[model samples]
Target chain A: MTKVKDIGEQGLLERLQRFCPPDVIGDDAAVLVTDPEQSLVVTTDMLVDGVHFSNATTSPEDAGWRAAAANLSDLAAMGATPLGITVALGLPGDLSVNWVESLYQGMTECLQQYHTPIVGGDVVRSPITSLSITAFGQVHPNRIIRRGAAQVGDAIVVTGVHGASHAGLKLLLDPQIGKHLTTTEQAALIKAHQRPQPRLDVLPHLWKILDNSKFKIQNSKLRINNSPSPQSPVPSPQSLTPVAGMDSSDGLADAVLQICRASGVGAVLESSQIPLPTAFDHWLTSEQALNYALYGGEDFELVLCLPPEAAKTLVQQLGQDAAIIGSITSDTKVLLHHQNQKIPDQVLNLSQGFQHFSP
Target chain B: MTKVKDIGEQGLLERLQRFCPPDVIGDDAAVLVTDPEQSLVVTTDMLVDGVHFSNATTSPEDAGWRAAAANLSDLAAMGATPLGITVALGLPGDLSVNWVESLYQGMTECLQQYHTPIVGGDVVRSPITSLSITAFGQVHPNRIIRRGAAQVGDAIVVTGVHGASHAGLKLLLDPQIGKHLTTTEQAALIKAHQRPQPRLDVLPHLWKILDNSKFKIQNSKLRINNSPSPQSPVPSPQSLTPVAGMDSSDGLADAVLQICRASGVGAVLESSQIPLPTAFDHWLTSEQALNYALYGGEDFELVLCLPPEAAKTLVQQLGQDAAIIGSITSDTKVLLHHQNQKIPDQVLNLSQGFQHFSP
Candidate 1:
């Protein structure tokens, strides 16, 4: 009598974890220690035609790019450099060959950008178009980041702005909303929803910081490239090891909740400090923008927990590229606070994200 | 203006090969040489509802087993020892959780039997059920088998009987035809269709022969278990290497044609020498049975081309488990002949092999 809808996606995942080996199901990617120094990270994601995208909104090329990006983001979460990927496509007979070619073009372009190739694939017949992509990568056994490693008192940091993708999706579904904004603003939001960039670019900087002396850091600005130049003279800080890390593909709140639950810690997110898009004030109320930042999904940004000094140093190094959103706490429940006033968590409905099985 | 149906699956594959890098798309699995001695073999297969298996005919568990077996067979073809597999499932919201649990049970059983565990996966909502499984394995660089290595004068050998799975599928789709069969016969045919075993068991024996001295042998009987015991006195012959090898999932004729095309050689199949299931003659005519053996697909047996002496040795070692049904030729076309007469190649329609897009 228990249907998939009754338990939801999380429930299904928990069931699968119980059914499979303990080490197999918990991480963003399964880490198989292949050698003394290197471990294999493998992850698979399935994208259904109706569930993941629609023909009305997503072109074949964009769909292909989105699918590849999603899997690559998982590898980024594990701090793994991709080896390659295998794409298995189930296409309907009525689909045009040109569409398929365009799809391959999109997928190949995205993969090539990340220095990964499409190493193998299978194309089969189906009633609807679907794609299943499995990406494999290599990471040093000692350097692999895990979601369950966050420590109490660790400062929370996030790369890039949140909720733009969600806002972009809203604009795409309702063109009338775009009438209120300039074409450039509309286009930026739409691009965010259609093409998410995996945070692979930030890994090298993070590893450098992790390898050096511990340092304190804090957030100030927003923009990855706008950060202080590498040549800029900055004070050396002590080496800092990241307590935990993951990609924020789900809404920011969901990402925080997952890290907290996995690490057996709680968090207090400073609402005023959370990053929002530059265009948010152009057309939307501050409260609406805040809601989008908190609950909007598919940001594809990196979320990390580090010591206070490390956070400060990272903020200084990355400049506006990274922000200090919150801090980990020993308390069992996640909290949200705006400046000096504590916000009632129930009113925010922070638990709501882009759940697949929810009505 | 062309649709996928117009080009068909093979045409689509050829197009993909042209689009992808030369080294990435041509093998049973993509063989990535990671180290001097070891190579990684990765393959992916996607199965869709109705197209692959209908809910009316296939239980959820059997569907799971079939999907796993299909991917594992690809690994076996490459002579690789599986490391693990990742499965991505797209299920409808109305599907029962118990159905998914049963599906996992089936996949687990098949994977465990081959010593490969399920490592990671993603499940999402879809209008129809679909499964994509990616299996990765490791093989010795020097020992890997390829489809493009057949040589003239090599003997063509096949493992087990062919067409049983196709016949099984036929029976499952049309129960009226199976009514003439006994209860045991019905069950046997149904089992063949539902659970085709990957030929991983034969890999070690083939490797042993490939590793050892070359020996001449011939097939006289029909059962793998009926072969002479290892303790029996058998003369050792000179060493021989396998020229080419692959699994016969796409029917024996297609397998032969593919090897010939890849290896740039011709072949002559001995019609009378081909292996058929014991139950074939009981109800079906000679021509119908032969048709099933030649063009009916999903056999999941091994088709190998080896030198005469090596083939003889393998036949002796494998006994009734293998059959020598053909030989490699300098001629450019694959032909079928009976005892003395060359059967007109056109009459047999050798090109037809369970094509997906065909009307």
Candidate 2:
């Protein structure tokens, strides 16, 4: 019997190359060779066997989609349009062909939605399953929105309500909590946890809003063009400036702290101003909601700071869905204001953010 | 202990999102934003612990460089200019940091040669070390080549001599052979096995030759008009016309058969004409050299077929470095003509290819 180690590294690579199609088989990465006018965008994420998922619960399909989506979210974060992806899968000998096919199906679904294809990959047998996906996208070089560009005095806003994914996870993991929820409620929460959507819809609108900020003095010309009549007037675009922003992958508190760290500023959040789902109140106390919103991770929502005038205009433009839950402050510390009192200084320092190296 | 399974698929992904810098974190894969006009090429290879390298004999640095080189060779085979890479490493907790850093250092050196940066990657603990690399390259779309395009009656040419790497491996694994060679000879053989170069220098010349082929007729007219004498001739560009081609990863015989199958044709190689390295002769018998050339894998040289007229021009242009080892034939079966006799059919039919699924 030949073991993988017996064949050696160069030998194993030689064997894997036999399976690749001659076209797109060799190159740094498989080249799409698409049009050159659009710039390329790239992202990567890794999954460990015991750390990322369990073979007992996660179907290969969900694992595959989640692996791809983890990287896709980065593209969405940059406001880059999706292109294609390459996957590197490590599997134990016990892995079945059926498992790989199902995983591919899940990945196919995500790729179809983004109009990207699986260009190439490497598959090798391992003692455990560790899947890593690297995705690429296209965007105009000038349109890339980085995390460091946020400004001070921008209205701090979040795209959606936080705590649903984390709450759903708690319910799924603990059967006791599952017993309290109806089947419909349980399914909704699980779906949110399993297949969260990247906020692709808001990208174009966000880009347009940012582009409008480039020309402040020419506001009258823009207003006149937008107005139906020459005499009619519209609000100035400068009043709606978006300053500093980031997507909340960590808890809201942690994400806000990161944004402040990047912008060299601080923030204060009003406890009453934070939004919560209707069912959240039924499951948790107000304190729990605050805790979940502040420290429970995986919200996948954008937290942004914009000018007060821009806040009003943005609200008018984006409607009531976007929430203004906090304000940037000069105090140089992220503070939670509750019931007309400042929380204890020690309470604000809780370290709940995810750490990759933590055992 | 927080097990990955307890977290579920979505929970694990959310956890991953927390650590990834939101700026370049997700999409179907990571989108490496680069200029659009630049050609994009991709290659991927996987190395499993025990199969590719053992902790006892193979150093981490060699393992890493070999892993990167395997993919880089595919890019070289495509004549694409190397650019960047993403790595996915699966490690055991017991593995030392010193080992991993050495691996990174080796990979960094190889990447630096091509000016390709390590754009992103995922690192996770596994039961064994499994490394996967996907590299990217840039080339003009017109210059990019594919393995399926080899034509019938094309001259089969190969870059450099084959079997040195395999000979080196034989010497390293067998101490008996090591004792037969002097210290200098052993070192040379070991070096060949450890560091295989991807021929990047020939890429530009190959591209130039391919470019000239496209407009030969139009260029002839322009040449006539510009010439001092009407009879002055415009030198014909060398041919890189591979109707069907592939790297000799699975031994020359298997790769040649692949080209034959892809082109729906066959091939004939003269046994006496096949180039064998001096070291190959020292370690292997004449019969063994034939066997290794037919079945011994890890010889990254390419096997290409070009039209007879083009072959003459290519041979002249490529000079002695590139050898015309064989030719595409009309027959359905790959044949070897030795002297006047065909030898026994069993010798040519010997299966000499690497199979990943072989138990």
Model 2 over residues B1-359: C-alpha lDDT tens digits?
45444544334445434323342222112222244334466666667888777765567777777776667777776666776677767666666555666787777776667766665555565677877777777654334444544555667877656666677677767758667566777777666566766656556655455456543443333233222213212223222223335567656777677677755677787766677666665666677776666676667666666555545565567665567877877776787767544454322443433231111
Candidates 1 onward: DockQ, in order:
0.54, 0.14
On the 0 to 100 scale, the lDDT of residue A313 in model 1 is 70
Query: Model 2 segments beyond 4 Å from truth?
Result: A1-38, A213-246, A304-321, A328-332, A339-359, B1-39, B213-244, B307-321, B339-359
TM-score of each: 0.87, 0.77
Error of 2 at A108 (Å): 1.8
Residue B113, model 2: lDDT of 77
Docking class of 1: medium
List the lowest-lDDT window of 10 residues for candidate 1 chain B.
Answer: B219-228
Write the residue-wise lDDT of candidate 2 on A195-297 in tens digits: 6665556576665565664433333333333322232122344432234465666577777887777566777777777776556767776777777777776
C-alpha RMSD of each candidate structure in angstroms: 9.1, 11.9
- Locate the minimum summed-lDDT window of 10 residues in model 2 chain B: B23-32
